[model samples]
Target: MSFGAQVLGTLGGIVVATLGGTLVYGAIRLTVGLRLDQEDEYNGADLSIHKISATPERESLG
Candidate 1:
């Protein structure tokens, strides 16, 4: 393909990806949820959700 065609194709692909991501994120946000609360976030997912740290030796980041 020509250079112009390649460029257009790349741009089109990027637009499609962006739109798809936005839609998926919007749906998820409307549904259950996307993120954790302040305390859970500070504790991290491994501890907050699983009740155990992935790295036992090192403490939580916060």
Candidate 2:
């Protein structure tokens, strides 16, 4: 396959895999009844799910 075709093919494969995985995951999440009552709405997934902040408070950084 040509270089362009190869890149396009790779991207196409990635897109398909990502979309399929997302659908499967969504269905599982729906069945399991896992909801994110995110206390750290401003903060993000790292702090919310992992219980560890990726970035320390600015004062702590100083």
Candidate 3:
């Protein structure tokens, strides 16, 4: 193959790989976000690891 054709092919491959990776990452993030949202709605906090308040009052600095 010609040098130009090889370079173009390499670039195309890289672009496709990057897009696929980005899509996978986005899908994972969306799934996680949805699960978390559902947990918040049903249980008020994430319970996979431990049960804790989603919001706790913090000491104010005055």
Best by TM-score: 1
Each prediction's number of clashing residue pairs: 0, 0, 0
Residue pairs clashing in model 1 are none
User: lDDT by residue for model 2 over 14-45, one digit each (tens)?
Assistant: 99999999999899888874555656666777
Determine the backbone clash count of candidate 1: 0
> What is candidate 3's lDDT per residue for 1-62, written digit by digit as tens?
89999999999999999999999989998776534555556875544436765555473233
- Model 1, 1-62: lDDT tens digits are 89999999999999999999999999999997899899999989988989987775646353
Best by lDDT: 1
Candidate 1 stretches greater than 4 Å from native: 57-62
Badly placed stretches (over 4 Å) of model 3 are 33-62
Candidate 2 vs candidate 3: the lDDT winner is: 2
Ranking by TM-score: 1, 3, 2
How big is the positional error of residue 24 in model 2, measured in Å on the Cα after superposition? 0.4
